[model samples]
Target: MSQFKVAAVQAAPSFLDVAAGITRAVAFIEEAAQKGAKLVVFPETWLPGYPNHIWLGPVAWQMQFVGRYFENSIEAGDVHDKAIAKAARDNSIQVSLGLSERAGGSLYIAQWHYDETGELIKRRRKLKPTHVERTVFGEGDGSDLVVKDTAIGRIGQLSCWEHLQPLSKYAMYAQDEQIHCAAWPNLKLYEGGAYALGHQVNNAASMLYAVEGGCFVIAACALVSKEQQDILCEGDPQKEALCPVGGGYTRIYAPDGQSIGADLADTEEGLVMADIDLSMIAYAKAAADPAGHYSRPDVTRLMLNSKPQRPVMAFDETAGLAMEAAEGAAAEADVVEIASAAE
Candidate 1:
């Protein structure tokens, strides 16, 4: 479709509770459909919440929350995953969900995209976990960089700082991605400590992605609720300052790098809606399409290995054993032949 309405969610997670988070996410999906939205995007790790505690203290101090976070994370195709997909199907709306994916006992920041029919079209993880995030999450690889062709448009997803990746952005642009879901965690982190983690810089990153890719950017950011703040801060005034209350800065940008989505109070939670016209990308691309007309292949090129980096490979044991036996038989025959020739 050339034109349609989309929603960028700006809210806190159910805070480390997968069941509650699934229910809340389904409600949001239904609400978006009711609002006449074709698609809805969610914030980073909205299911079971972001690991705010990782930023609060060192490794030993963070030990308390690690187990709980892992326990709450959802595995792909698990009950929680199916619940979100069912919601999309029931509502007849597309969904792009940010979540903490638990696969083989390791958690990775992931985004799940479901088509209107409730089939999972794409699932991507952050190629690299940012700073303290590495403490709790595993890293994704090149295979995670994906842009899918949906009935609505070419949609792609990236989480948090993945927006800051120049080459990664180019990869999506090359795929002719039309709607980019930029999932982000609550920007209200380290209140006074890091400017990079704050609102302005991250929003700029999303805008840049829109401009460079000539695609719609739905930047969804999670918030730090009162309950989350209490858990992370633990009543320490110093901790509170770092993990202070509101950290939501959700926004949507046009292909021309304009902020088209409406605003809410940084502390308030709601969906930031925008009407996206895919054809507008042509206008923006005419000005500059980094991966297309504005190219310099001889001067610079990106080497993208879009393969899943797996830790293990399984082969058929029977086949392997048969091959070994065949080789042993061949060796025995060769030895007997040599002995006969000597005789």
Candidate 2:
């Protein structure tokens, strides 16, 4: 639809409990649907939670949470995944969900999009996991950068710092994305020291994205509960100082770069709902469409390699096998001809 209501989720996950996370996610989905939201966007790694501990302690010391986090990460198309999709279908709401995607022995930051009918329309991973996130997550390829058109509109998504990528943002804008899910983990963890990672900076990034891309931006951020603080800090003053609680800075913005949703307390858990009209993008883009008439493509352009980067590829043996079979048939024919000549 051209105009509709949407929700941005700003709640902490169940923290290393996939089952509990799924249950909570389903409840939120149902609740959003009841509230007349056609779509709901979740924060980054909402399932199994973001590993803020990686930034808190040394890798060796933080190994305690690694195993549990890996085990709790959700797999695409798994039963846990189907449950979330089912919830969307039952409620007839579109969902843009963020989580850690597990494949074989590795995990990648992922966002899955489900249409109102519950069909998975797209699943994208972060092209590059940021900072210490590399310790636990693998990188996604250009193929992961995609924008899909559905009954609602063209939906695209990026997790956390992916929005910070200038080229990545341009690529999505080029595809004419109408609605964007800018998923983020808590921003206030190290606010005392890391000013760049605070709500002011990250929230500005989301607002700039709406203005730049001429698309509605759903900036969903996660909160840090006391339970999460205790687990990571372990009653240590230093650790507590680094990654403190309360970072939920959830918001939604219009194509004109204005806040469209009401505010929520930094520590509070809830959804930020906003009504968006795609028609607004037309005027916004009319003045300056970076990827369109306003751009100087003759001077610069992006080289997007949207191909799946696989580690291994098996070669085809069919040609060699066919040659061998043909040789054997020829040999048999010669022998039969010789026997006939001898007779």
Candidate 3:
């Protein structure tokens, strides 16, 4: 019908301080709302902070800070739900914020969305954790890849490096996602090599992918500073954990591979707004659709099916079955023994 206004909020989050981060994020949301933002998206791990210690190698293992990191992380419970919902309702704007979710004694990089009425809209977890992040974060199942139909548009989410995985992006595209949320951490300023290039390339790739899929893409990245490092990094200040300073390249792109805003500052706390005409998607898709005219189903096939479930047994039945099965299997294997003459 009409163009929608979306904002990509780029800012540095306080380390291990959920309350303070939420407070700061709420202020930004208020500002964006005041500027007539219909939807506002945040960077990855903006709730508390990104666990940079995991990248410290041996120091991270010996420090055993993951427990403390999980302790300060947010849980997807009523308390957090209420607080976030209230923030969205107060601002009268739809919000999508990324955070470290602690659930079932496991940690996941998660994104939570709240509607204008303060109702919880959607919650999605990162499909796979990055290289070092696997040691601290758990993998998400298919249930986490959700594309919900919202008032503004059909919104979907993918976190950090997951955008690099073609299959993951295709999954969202197949569902016809309108507004894709791609979240990432700021590139390490000191580790200037493939890591930095990967960040920039991945962001550009995701935007291009969205264009190919004919969807609006919002690429949000965390902006960490020396002050944020002081709070997040619990170890020595001179260590490599805090070596990288700031790398905030938050951006917004349209459905035609056009950049709306790019190369934003780390400390600048504001909204990067764009007016997206949903009709552009129809125009682009008519030319080339990946799943339609562009795909060759004759030579190639990708079929996914659900696996069969294992049988379940009662407690006593399980114990007896295990013992009997073990004894039978062992007896059939070998029956050779030597007798001692002295005995």
Candidate 4:
């Protein structure tokens, strides 16, 4: 499709409850569908919530929520994932979801893209968990850096800080990605301190991604509720200065780096919808396509290994044993032939 409407969800997760979060997400999806959204995007780690505690407290202090966080994280094809897929299927809308993925004993900040039929089209983890994020999340691999051709367009995504990685962004651009989902945690100024992370920085990152990639950017950010801040910072006096509320700044950007639609209130929980014309990408690309004519392949080239990283590889034990036996028999025959020659 050359033109369509898309939605970016700006809301807090249901704290650390997967079921509650799923229910909330489905509601958002259905609402977006009702609003005529072809694709809906959610904030970073929307399911079961972001681990703001890691940034708020020391490791020893943050230990309290670790188990709960793990317990609430979604496993691929598990009940939580199935629920999300069903929601997309029921609404007949494509969904791009940010979630905390649990596997074995470790957790990863993951994104799940479901097609209109609710079939998972892409699943990716953050290639490198940013700063404090490393405390609770595992790194993704090259295979995660992929764009899928969909009914909407060639869609691809990168989690929170992945936008900061130039090579990663170029990889997506190289694939002719037309729709980009830039997921992020709440961008807030907790203490009004001089060192606080500014909203400008995150917003610029998304805009730059659209400009450089020549694609529509759906910048989805989560909102920090006062209750969530209170929960995370209950005992520590520093918590007040750490997990402040009102950090949402969800937006959509055109391929030329212009903001799309009406801006949502920073503290409000809602969807930011934008009607985008994919043909605009051509105009933007003509100005500058970093991965295309605007680039110098001889001066610099990127080697991308898209092999999926796995901790284990299973082989058929019966077949392996038979192969081993055959090899042993061959060795025995060689030895016998040598012995006969000697005699």
Whole-model lDDT values for every prediction:
0.87, 0.89, 0.73, 0.87
Backbone collision tally, model 1:
0
lDDT of 1 by residue, 175-210 (tens): 888999999999978766789899999999999999
* Candidate 4 backbone collisions, by pair: none
Q: What are the RMSDs of all candidates, in order?
A: 10.3, 11.8, 12.0, 9.8
* lDDT preference between candidates 1 and 3, better one: 1
- Estimate, for each residue in 138-182, the C-alpha lDDT of model 4 and write its tens digit: 999988988999998999989887998988887788888999988
Question: Which stretches in model 4 have alpha-carbon errors above 4 Å?
Answer: 189-191, 194-196, 235-237, 316-343
Q: Give the CA lDDT, 0 to 100, for residue 99 in model 3.
A: 89
Q: What TM-score does prediction 3 earn?
A: 0.82
Better of 1 and 4 by TM-score: 1
Best by lDDT: 2
**Residue 96 alpha-carbon offset, candidate 3, angstroms:** 1.4
Please list the residue runs of candidate 3 whose C-alpha ends up more than 4 Å from where it truly belongs after superposition: 59-64, 195-198, 231-242, 304-343
